[model samples]
Target: MGRSRGGYSTKIHVSVDGLGNPLELRITGGEKSDITQGEELIEGWQRKDTKVIGDKGYDADKLIEKIGEAQAVIPPKRNRKTQRHYDKHLYKERHLIECFFHKLKQYRHLFSRFDKLARNFLSFLYLVSALFWLK
Candidate 1:
């Protein structure tokens, strides 16, 4: 958990399949940047033909290079000097991740951050994700 004006907080980072089912999940300090966990989320991913879609926060030179053969469909930040083009149609699929989060938040406990321990929270996350897979 991380301390901020509101209180202790944590960030849940998830990677989902093309179908919007979660593939991996990680917890980080609320203050941590999204890019910090980018590499680890896709570390052992072996799919070379897939497109890696993400929001602007995941846009970075190292991450783009790390994507290797997989096409990085992340949009560049507004402040970037060079505006790189990405497949707009593919980028639209990013809403799947947003939808997944909306569903995850519907669970009151997870939404309210009742679990103080990260491990407990993550365990519940795994359980919930498994439930999603079962559906």
Candidate 2:
């Protein structure tokens, strides 16, 4: 879930490569925690050890543990006085996700909450993602 002028906009979280190609995507409520959706997206999908990257929103300890060999490059959230560590260089790769969202929002079905059911919305989301991957 990401904050926007429309308030908390529902995000269809996705994992992509350097080219912004979709590998997996999961729809999350506008107010849901990013860490809550992390493992769910990767379960049964990871083919090998992978590297996960995100902003401070995915900085939960449990989510990091679940990812195993896949390193999390999540930055520490501000206002957390406690000092923490992350891979600064690797985290730069998170731009891929930003690029992916930019492309996704270009689609009408994806940018707006038109479908009544989550399943239907997810179906459209998947269809769009498939098309992105095909190109």
lDDT of candidate model 1 versus the reference: 0.90
Worst 10 residues of 1 by lDDT: 42-51
Give one digit per residue, the lDDT tens place, for model 2 in 21-122: 988878877777777887786675433467777778777777767767776677878877775788898888888889888888898876777775778888
Candidate 2: worst 10 consecutive residues by lDDT? 41-50
Reference-based TM-score of each model? 0.95, 0.81
The models' CA-based lDDT, in order, is 0.90, 0.76
lDDT of 1 by residue, 20-118 (tens): 999999999899999999998887663688788889989999998898888889999999998999999999999989999999998998989999888
> In order, how many clashes per candidate?
0, 0
User: How many clashing pairs in candidate 1?
Assistant: 0
Clashing pairs in 1: none
